[model samples]
Target chain A: MNLVIVLLIIGLLMIVAGCWCLMRTFHLLKMTIGIEVAMKAVTLFLVLAGRISGKIALSETFVITVMVAEVIVAVVGTGTAVGLFRKYGSMDVRNLKQLKG
Target chain B: MTILSICAHGFIYGPILVVLIYNLFNHEFARKHFFWFAGTGAVWQILAAIGGFTALNQNGQTSYAFGAFWDIRLAGAAFFELNATRFLLLLIVGLVALISVLVAHQTVDFNRSSYTNLLMILVLGMNGMLLVTDLFSLYVFLEVTGLCCFIMIAMFRSRADLEGSFKYLILSELSGIFILTAIAFLMMKTGSLRYADLAGLGQRISAGSGQLEDLLVYAALILLISGFAIKTGVVPFHSWLPDAYQSADTAVSILLSGAVNKVAGVYGLMIVMQLFGDVAPVGPSLAAVGIISIIIGALLAVRQPQYKRVVAYSSVSQMGYILLALSTGTTLGLVAALAHILSHTAFKSTLFTNAAALQEQTGTLELKDLGGLENQMPVTAFTSIIAFLSTAGIPPTAGFWSKILIILALWQAGSPVLAGVALVAGILSSAYLIRLQRTVFFGQTRPELAKVREVRGSVLTAEVLLTVITLGLGLLYPYILLLLHAGGIL
Candidate 1:
């Protein structure tokens, strides 16, 4: 029980850090790193929660899927960032405001 | 494996296979054979429609079963089940998917075979999303669809397109994370991630167990709503919508406005919430967002110079009607929502195709630059009129019928204010749409537009076919009502 609580706290900390990276960071690469961290947190929670409920396999599958999704999202996001860099030569979020309402 | 289930699998995977086989060849070969994918999709829709129609005639099956398909247990925990309305929803999506790809072929400049490949992936994702019964697998499919759409948007590799794709990617990623977190909470609380498990719990609660006082479930529910609302482009959560629509290719716009957002946002929410009850727990808040989208989209669309952006905002507004119907929490309301979805998908897609044709000929999509095109491009003019009138809920159009039902549902459900506001928005829509119609197609022909000729091939066919179908449904409104009633929607 104590181990589960400790794991949950670590997961929560990672979640906060991941969100901070996404919400506050301006660099696209850093933003991706933030998402990756959050994904790791989700992975931890899934496995620990599974262990708590005696469904480790189910949680592990979830972890695997999340990792796969994270990879795809990261790869695609990097490709997009490269394209943006080619077009505008910047990785800043504020620079992507051309479509004014 | 039963023969029938194998055949059912063909309906989902057959078009995907066809598209993949074509892509294995050179780009020129794939470009020439884009319609083959459409052909496969049409065949699938016809078969599904026939099956659904037969089921309707038989009053449909009452049992909801999953855990296996053709004696195949998915190693993954994902499962499949049918709602009373599944076949109908599938049939509608199949039609939209077919037309959307056909329109996309006409609109996009083919740079590679992968363009068609991405579209096939999108259709597969949407099919899985609508059909999959497990919440986790459903989210997987949703992300697949979202990823495909993101990639497709950036296919043109233009600065505007890239920016639009990037914004859309970030927002969609955020929504995805929210959905994942929500599902995790639900899974933890319930010890199962299947829809059946959640539905069973909800059933017990409704059957005199107790009022749902669980904070985790409530938190999960709110997160799910927020995630899908951002996806659906409802007001306040709709910042990326117009940018993506205006910047993406015309065919992509049709796919996005007509099908993807509807499926990912509205239908996604509906399916998840169905486990709880007919009227979802978040109905009131969703309805509030829907109303805000309607008025704000209408007001903003009227002032836009770009025709695509105009249509894009109008899409946000039209979706409001569907969402309002959904929030009413009655079978009649569901029927209204489905009906509106069909009409909107039909006319809105046709309108976007017409917009594409205009841009193709005029080299401009700005409203101010277009005038008196009817004399030159009569098919586009005539069909666009039908399309916009249908959008504005004018009589004898399917939009008219669906809007009436939605308004009636609201009033009968004791929200006369919303009914009145929706009725007034109908007039507001006509005002702007008529303004656009007159500016673009009526009055004196601009000197440049006078030489423009109507597109004489597949583009015209797609537009006319969708417009004709919308008009036909309106003309045969009674038959649709009878069919829905037969299908147990009423």
Candidate 2:
């Protein structure tokens, strides 16, 4: 239980840190790094929680699967973002409003 | 199971398998490949349904008693067990996927492979969700589905879709947190993850020990249901739905409002009730949520200008009716809830498809901009009218019967107030829906709508098929009710 609490706190702090990182200048690489950090925090939190509760680490397999899925998704997202950047010469989301309501 | 029946499971897996097999030979097929793929899926569903019926007749047992396809073993506990309900839910999901693909092929402009591939993954996750019985397994599939939708929405590459997708992702993440924490609590209390075991624990509660355990259970249920309610777009948590539904591409909207919301929200709620009754032992909190959703969703829906938003809010209100009926915990109530789910999917899909087709023609989904469409797209307008009336609970329609059954259940449960509220909502439903039809299709044809031709034959056929099914559901209401009873739900 104590270990789970620690992991949860770590996950919370990592999220806060990731948000802080994102709030800095909107660099794509930086944002990606922060998100990856946050994901790792989440994975660690799940693993520790399972271990502390004497539960089997089904999460180990789950995280590996999710990571592979994330890579595919990130590739698509990055490709789209890059396409938008090339079209408009900017990566800032605030200025990209071709179809806004 | 018969050899043919086992092969039917292969059929459920056929879509993904087809994609993989096709990838081996060629990256692109003829432009009409989706039709062939979807046709195969449809044929698969019919075969599975027929096989399921045969299995029922021959064995005197209807439901397949399969364990969870992917079970996780612990030192002293088993964590998951999927069974007949799960299989049926998957079959329904498979059908929804094929329909969504057809809708996509007809409406959306797929520039590349990403769109179709992501859509299939979304369907895969939804199918997996319905087939998983463990709370944690369900959560995993929920996240998978959420991710798929987030990606699909982002693929629109429009500012509106981006904002909507981000909002949806944030809300979905929050709901994911709630589901996980609630599951953790359930694990803490029951020391098991299987639905059957949790039901056993819930049943084993003696009179004195029932209250605290029930309260904790209620709290967990509240967390779980609220998570699903947000995803389901029920009121209070429904603010995100209009934007998401409006901004998403037409095909995504069909899946979102029709299958995904019902699967993630309504089906999720029903499974929860199967484990723990809907009444939430803590002074009818779930009922309170239901009543508020019904009233608020209807009231807000009356003021919506966008056609898709109106359908979206109506879904919120309709979900309230479902939850209210479920709260009664009677056979009639459960059956009413299930029946409403079937009808809502049929009508809602048709409504959204028509709205999307109209938007494509007239360049706007706003009702104010869409006056007198009946003269332009006769088939679309007629199909929309049928869907709208049925949704508003007109007589001899599936909606009316389900609404009646729910109200009857409410009355049986001694909730005259809710029964009366449901009646008022039904009336309000008619008022707004009728207003929608009159404003959009019955007036003078605007110049903008003058050149709005009927959508392609394929889109029209899809809408008509959905409308026919909606009407057929009304005609075959008894048979569906019987199926529900046979499933031991009622």
Among these predictions, the greatest lDDT belongs to 1
Separately for all candidates shown, the number of backbone clashes (residues 3 or more apart, or on different chains) is: 0, 1
- Could you tell me which 10 consecutive residues in candidate 2 chain B have the lowest summed lDDT? B74-83
lDDT of 1 by residue, B171-229 (tens): 88878877887777677667677775777555333323343324546667777888998
Per residue, candidate 2 scores C-alpha lDDT tens digits across B128-237 of: 67656577677777877887787777787776776566556656655665565566556645655667667755565543564443444555777887888788888788
Positional deviation of residue B224's Cα in model 2 after best superposition, in angstroms: 1.7
Q: In model 2, which residue pairs have backbone atoms overlapping below 3 Å? A: B68-B82
Q: Going through the candidates in order, what fraction of the true interface contacts does each contain? A: 0.34, 0.03
User: Which parts of model 1 are misplaced by more than 4 Å?
Assistant: A1-13, B1-7, B52-77, B82-84, B200-213, B278-281, B482-490
Q: Model 1 chain B — which ten-residue stretch has the worst lDDT?
A: B204-213
Worst 10 residues of 1 chain A by lDDT: A44-53
